[model samples]
Target: MKLVDVGGRTMAYHRAGAGPALVFLHGGWSDGRAWGPQLAGLSDGFDVIAWDAPGCGGSDDPPREMTMADYADAVAALVAELGVEAAHLCGISWGGGLALAVWQHHPELVRSLILVGAYAGWKGSLPPEEVEARVRRLLAEAERPPAEWMDAYLPTFFAGAPPAGSLELVRSMMLDSRPGGLVPMLTAFADADLNAVLPTIAVPTLLLWGEHDDRSPVGTVAQALRSAIPAAELVVLPGVGHEVNLEAPEAFTTEVRRFLQAAGATLIRVSRATCALCGQQAASEDVPLTWMTSVEDGRKRLYCDRCARENVRSIEGKLDPVYW
Candidate 1:
């Protein structure tokens, strides 16, 4: 365990390995230890750092009024204190939102981003009311036989059959978590909205989603993210849940390793015609250009034809015939 003074708070973190820094941010109802499986495997290849967020595990409790931006700032401060110029950032669930916030506000410090079961906001698609209801139910059931109760809630987080011991692990973590810490974290999550900042993230991004994640459903949130962020890759894992890293460590590590390796490469081949406007390779001619945007001065600033036409129509009071 290591402690760093971040904004007057004693933040607790654990580090291993010796190469490029890789920071792991755990989701709600979980602490940094949730990333144990991933750290165990990835630490050997990279410098893996996992920390307990404010009020969780070994960290000091932050005020209940703390916002997502505050959490992101804390992470940025930690990176600076460690003298790491850049690092790979990975987060799950609520932590995923924090990771996105960090990337949005501190792109220069991020080498790449990996988000699992993340959401843009609670407004669109998954309404706050629905998420609140589900979270309430799960929290209420925490005192009961966690394994059995969690089995019912598991479907929302995962896709196919739950992996052996998956429920048990979740149950243990839930039981061990500090309920006092969870309250404000959940409140901060309810207030998060990363949509406005998504496009500002310039680092390579990989979104890992469970095929049947109810908390942050795959189709709407994942698709929206893929469309919003340029050069972002979405990987939907079959038969997995909200905790893909725990449910399928092998699969999760494989995808992460591949993305990191690709990110480190110097020469990337992108189509001239397609890459001219959007810096990504066009997989097929039929690929939709709605989300494809142009990068300007190292920052992706190009808007798709649809967005351009919409802007013109909004201002000119008429649709452009050429765009149509």
Candidate 2:
């Protein structure tokens, strides 16, 4: 367990291994420990950091009035404090919403995105009536004894039966929840509608969803996201549910590892690319590279940070670099 101060709040995170930063954001009612399999399993090949968001796990409770922007800023601050220039953000459920918020606000700090059983926020994806009902149910659950709700909630968490000890694992994590944290975090989730931010995302994105996910069904929510984000890839884990990582950890880990390795290779290619405008070489793979599809041949062309900044408009317009 490691701690950092972000915006005067104490944030706790579990980190392992060393390489390109791969930060995990868990679903609502869960904490960083929810990512235990990922943190330990993927650490061998990449730096894996799982954080207990404000009001969850070892972190301090956020104010009742906390908004999505506040959550996004705290995440960006935490990553910067850890000396990670950019990270591949992997989030599930509500955490996936937070990941989208982070990318919407801090695009420069994100390398790629991995969203599992995610939402474009309830408002962005679900019917208004359904969103309200879910919000009310969650709020009521926060007020009840953990045991009373766990039995009912546990059934919905998985597609069919849970793996041995999986039910206990989820129960223990939910027992640690408090209303102060739960209400505000979930409220932010319900209110968020990041549909507008989807088309603007330029980074590589991988969407993992359970084929039988009840909470965020792949057909509606996942397909909507896939259609919205540019070049996004979707992988459905058969016989899984919203808790895809818990029920199918091996398959989940494999998909994530393959996606990240491929994304890393693209970064390596970007590192080797000479700036078409300035003929300058990138200092490292981490250096930012702006890639534009050639209007004529559709091949990707690279520009270094300086040249990219100087002609941002031209690049946005997809005008040929030769003309710039």
Candidate 3:
């Protein structure tokens, strides 16, 4: 863990490897340590940094009145302090909202964006009633013992039972979350509405989602994001849930790497086409395979027209076509 003072607030972060900078911003309930897998896995290829935002992990509690813009400026200060010219910001959930805030406030510092189980903002993606309910729940949960609430709440973040130790790791982080920090950190997002900011994004943006994400359901939230961000690509991890990074770390990391590489490429040229779901080959030169760029590897994925139409809803929902 590294410590830096940005505007009198001591922000903490973890860094590893060396290459183009990749910064990870965790969700409301999590701190920088939640990105352990990403920091370690992507270290060999990039300079990965994960920060514990104000009120989370080793960072100090923020003022009750702290705004998302304040958080964005804090991120910019940290990046400037680290001497990085630009970076790819990858954020999940509330962190995703912060990433949008950063892009809005500090566009020049961002090279690209990767948002997982993300939202434009609570107001931008969720219905007004749902947003109120979620904020109310967060307020209630902030005062309850971590164990009592997490037992029932945490399951909603995963597709099924979490792998052994996964739940424990998240539980420990939630346990460490202070109400002083958590309340402010969460409420800031509750009041945010970045719908206007979405259309202004000029950087390469990738939207990753868990097919069964109950909190930020792919069909509603992810699609709203995709339709708003011009040319943003969406990839749905099958059988995954809201905690896309934790539930499918390898896939999450791979997709990030692939998106970064593609974003940096001078030109995109396809050599062959095959259905990512059915493994069927495209038969003719004129046949167009529906594009699905972020598969496990670097190959460009395309679904046959037959498969595409049959599973159009799933594809639009960004689910693994296999499920269709």
Best by lDDT: 2
Give residue 139's error in model 1 in angstroms. 8.6
**Model 1 agreement with the true structure over 1-324: per-residue lDDT tens digits:** 788888787888888888889999998767877787777889878999988888887788888687778788788888888878679999998888888878766655677789888876454336777768856864675456544554465556556555677666666766656655676677677767788666555556899988767677787888988887766789988877788898888899999888888877522221222322434534554333332222333322323454545432222232111110
| Model 2 segments more than 4 A misplaced | 267-324
Candidates in order have lDDT scores of: 0.71, 0.82, 0.81
Worst 10 residues of 3 by lDDT: 315-324
Clashing pairs in 2: none
Compared with the true structure, what per-residue lDDT tens digits does model 2 show for residues 176-243?
A: 88888788888888898999777656667899999999999999999999988867889999999999
TM-score of each: 0.75, 0.83, 0.81
Pitting candidate 1 against candidate 3, the one with the higher lDDT is 3
At residue 180, give the lDDT of candidate 2.
80
RMSD in angstroms between candidate 2 and the native structure over all alpha carbons? 7.9
Q: Can you list the residue pairs that collide in candidate 3?
A: none
Candidate 1: list runs displaced more than 4 Å.
Answer: 132-155, 159-166, 266-324
Q: Superposing all C-alpha atoms, what RMSD in Å does each candidate have to the true structure?
A: 9.2, 7.9, 12.4
